[model samples]
Target: MTILLFGITKDIVGQPTLSLSHSEAQGLHTAGELKEFLKDNYPDMKKLSSLAVAVNSEYAQDEHAIKEEDEIAIIPPVSGG
Candidate 1:
């Protein structure tokens, strides 16, 4: 599974994308699980107030199921004046 990062998420991750081998993605059945996995690996991600997970280019709730072939993205909070 590959997760695209945007905005501050990219900065925190220090990369534009995170690639997970099939074995690494095996237990991540839901969006929430994926989020937790990210936080565990990249603790800095936990500092963000909010995070959005997109699956197949669509916003996904915690319950949203994810597949190894699905496209996922991490979108951090945005603020503008």
Candidate 2:
């Protein structure tokens, strides 16, 4: 699984994208699972109230399934002029 973070999300993760190998993405199967994985992996993100995820260039709902080859991105809310 590959994950990308944009805007402030990149700042949080310290990178624009992460290439998660099969072994690295273990036990992950859905968008919800991905969120849980991130929450467990990075304690900082655990406190966030909300976030958005996209799978394969499209918005992902909780019910959206994830695949090993899917390209996922984590999006954070922003306010800028």
By lDDT, who's the top model here?
A: 1
Question: How many pairs of residues collide in model 1?
Answer: 0
Tell me the alpha-carbon RMSD of every candidate.
1.0, 1.3
Clashing pairs in 2: none
Candidate 1 wrongly placed segments (more than 4 Å): none
Sliding window of 10 residues with minimal summed lDDT for model 1? 72-81
Task: Return the top candidate by TM-score.
Answer: 1
* TM-score, predicted candidate 1 vs. hidden true structure: 0.94
**lDDT per residue (tens digit) for residues 1-81 in model 2:** 779887676776788887787787777878998888887877778767778999988999877998888889998788799
Q: Give every collision pair in model 1.
A: none
